[model samples]
Target: MEVKLHDIGEGMTEGDIISYLVKEGDRVSVDQPLVEVQTEKMVAELTSPANGTVKEILIDVGKTITVGTTILTIASEQGADPAPAKEETAATVAPAAPSQKSMIMERPKGAPLSNRVKAAPYTRKVAREHDVDITLVEGTGRAGRITVEDVLRYVEERDNGKTKAAAAPEKTPSVEKEPVHQPEEEFDTIPFKGRRKQIAMKMSQSLFTIPHVCHYEEIDMTELLDFRKELKAMDENISVAAFFIKALAIALKEYPVFNAKLDEENEVIRLEKSVHMGIAADAEEGLIVPVVRDADKKSLRAIHQEMKELTQKAKENKLTVKEITGSTFTISNVGPMGSIGATPIINYPETGLMAFHKTKKMPVVNEHDEIVIRSMMNVTMTFDHRVADGGTAIAFTNRFKSLIENPKKLMLELV
Candidate 1:
């Protein structure tokens, strides 16, 4: 059976071969991870479809392949003779006709996973002594030489920094315990087609496709902070981001235009009812946004718990396609990251995005006109101009600020 690269989601056309979880000649069970692939959105594992021996690996690490491209050939062990002096028929030997032979020649069978290696006599001796598989050890020495140190370090880190090979444990028959693809050595130029490439494509699309208008506002976060502190004191814990999400949901409900997509092809702005808020997170790979589904209907605690779980999943690169898609609105809480202000790009197809900047104590005039210290945060609301006007953006932000400033009111809106 041939194992082909399948589409994960979001119209994924291609993926980079990260590593083979099960090595060639190893046995793999059904659903056992066969290989690790780096897709545009996330790193995913392709599993074995049946119990078999990994007959051949057609693709190599770092090679990019498209969907339906065969990457591995597995020989199924189910209902087959273990000891083969098994008879080979004429069909198995070669094509019967000229036309069929030509068709077989046209198809490219990717190079087998088994590859040749180069090493010095001393390095070879060291590798053999340590029982390290020299063929799997990538060389870092001059002219791609497999050095002794490289072999030792691979043994040491056989487990740490498990980006590629870590997904498969020792219990799995397929994993060969090779080091995951780690960019250990410095390079003058790097391949530009992983998470970085995806971000570039999406950002360029959003910028060129949508006319962005940014509105800035300074919010007094003193009330919200105090409210949170009081809640913490009373053992009622909730994150400020959750409150922000809830308030954004309420404001989105009021200003339904902001929670909309301008369907240019359809020539109408489609306003969405359910609020799926995408929480932008900074993971090890790049910027990831995991959606908080139905933020409008969830309470502060529920939002907080879900946001915490989503954040963890995003950081770990374990978020499913459903968890990252169908977001009607998005928010980038850069306050913790110490960003003062930024005109964040709208998560394409969504009309607006909110970015919260660092909050700090600043002197402000109270209603009585006396100077008082307040926690102030800068926020920028970026919207697609074709879908909404500046007045509407201002009104939307004002409503959001009103809800954030008066926690009691925000809670009332929530209930």
Candidate 2:
């Protein structure tokens, strides 16, 4: 059976082969990861569909191939003789001396061959911008492939003179000190591919297609903080973001327009039956939002657990297609990163996005007219003006704010 590259969802048409987990002649189980492919949104592990013995690998690592292309040939039965490796063709003899370019291309004695340098196209680009020879930098990825981090680490070491000292350096001509000022100007160029490209496209579309209206509110989280501490004492590791998600879910129920999607072609507002909350998590590749399905139906602890699992999977580049899609509403919490506030763009197809910043202690007048120190947090909501009016947006944010500010009321409703 031929193991073709199947669609990994999100309308992805192609993927770059990151690395192969199994080699020819290796037996694989059904659903076992066969290879890691870098798609537009994430690096996903393409799995074997059936139990089989790997026969032939059609695609090489770092090669971008279209979907439905056969990547591997597998024998359905075991003990099949593996196909022989392709023979290399004899090199044609060239006349006399090599050209200037060919001479410069020669690897240093004892250095790794350029053709053997295992690096992604983006990693190679970074190497070029820094003038760092990738063949000299050791690869740290699977199968000794060079990753972005490895290239960056090499650049750092070279800049710090650690790696340079280990290798022979080119001689520089001595010049007398004459107050010559040469400021060092350096920058890295990151190729917009994979997840970063997807993020850029979606963000641009959301900003242009949706008429956005932002509503800002500040909530006192002192009570919420106390409640979290109490929960923590009980060994419940629920976070403040979970509480905010719950409050947003409740508010969405009250204001259905905010929980709806706009069908511009049909000119209709489709209210979602269930609240699926997307948590915008910053992963290594880029920003990815993994959704929590039926968030309104789950308890705060359940939500927290799911959030942790999804976040971990996202960061580890293990998120499934179902986990990263289908959110009616999304929340981006920059609070942990020490951001005070942010006007986040709406996640495309979703009508609203909620952004919250770091909580800080400040003096505020209490209901009893006494000035008291309290933990305050800023919350911003960016909504589609087409799907919801300004009044509806304001009401929704106010309801959300009210729930967050009154922790007891919010907890009682949960009960």
Candidate 3:
């Protein structure tokens, strides 16, 4: 029978063939990883449907195939020889390695956190980092469960407090003052699943796939700060992030490649016609970037509304699959979190990303000797070196900074 492959998720109608693990004429058993697919969400491994010999392999690597596409053909050996089939039935199949289940766990669909194991997420994390086997630890909590204290105790006893005590020669570090035991109660740890997993994968892909060039510049935002205050006084709901988004859209009109993506396979560069801007939101999970499509045409109120809606959707886990994909460019703002400046990872496929940090009032000396306190914010723009040079990237950032500092320039009289 022909083995037809179907999309494993709702929004995924097709996927780019990452690679085929098994080749034609290769013997394969049931449930072995046969192929891998790159969908919008995550890399999914397609396993063998039955115990059979590979007859034919269809489709090439990097080809985008749709649902119900024939990935490969497998010929069942059972009916070929009745004696072999009977022998196979009587043969005992050794159980899979016991360590497999510990490495992989089922994540509940939709809700990323519901179906995970009972241990605190951070405790599991600590064990993994220290190379301590979590399965071996005894539990003192209810239901014979492992707790954070249990994991910490394991670490302390295993290391004999050598590293912790070595850090300070004055006295043995008080167990009461163990640094890792900080006020974790302040934050709820959300499972890194769904969009969060996609975010992490993309971030790592960006770092590994592209050569990044981070160009930094400090801009005087005195006028912009006053203008922002004026706008806020007129309407308190107007956000600085919205203003930054608008300024970024204006700058993209001047520097196009900063809003471009590399089509490496086809040796083509794609400059997006419409600016779909993304605002980074750090929710209970990790950072999520939800795009605002056709942002150049949206009014300030429209921008604010879209941003508010996306933020709400991100927090409530109500964002549709489409909301997480497709972006010409992205921006990460940590001003709300009080971060001054940070070098951010570019969201992959997008050639560039800009990060906005907290604005601080600092004393500055003008072209004249007059010293005055001016409001300034640090802007760090990271670009893919393969697409844009340092000069082009810097020019893009400076233009963006100018629009932000003037604010009225972004509000040009005639649209």
Question: Top model by TM-score, which number?
Answer: 1
Which is superior by TM-score, 2 or 3? 2
Q: Write the per-residue lDDT of candidate 1 for residues 321-367, one digit (tens) a residue.
A: 88988899999999998999898999988999999999999999999
lDDT of each: 0.83, 0.81, 0.73
Candidate 2 per-residue lDDT, tens place, 1-415, comes to 7777777765455678889999998989999999988876677888887787888898899777667767887787654545544323224323435674576477566476445666666567667867878888878765567765677788788778876557767879987688979898898898666677657646755765688888888988888889888888988878888888999999999898888998766978899999999999998889988999999999998999999999999889888889987899999999889999777899888999999998999999989999999999988889998888788888888888888888889987783
Q: What does candidate 3's lDDT look like per residue over 1-415, in tens digits?
A: 3555575643344566778899987888888899987654445678887888887776788765556677777887774312212111113544446574543355332222223244544456556756877765666854445655576677777777544335657856665754565554576786433445445545655665688888988888788778867877877667788887887888887798988999987998899998899777776656766789888878877898899999998887556546766778999988668988788888877999898878899999998999999988888898999999998888888888878777787788215
Candidate 2 overall lDDT versus native: 0.81
Q: For model 3, give the 10-residue run with minimal summed lDDT.
A: 81-90
**Model 3 / residue 119 / CA error / Å:** 29
Worst 10 residues of 2 by lDDT: 87-96
TM-scores of the models, in the order given: 0.70, 0.67, 0.57
Cα shift from native, residue 42, model 3 (Å): 11
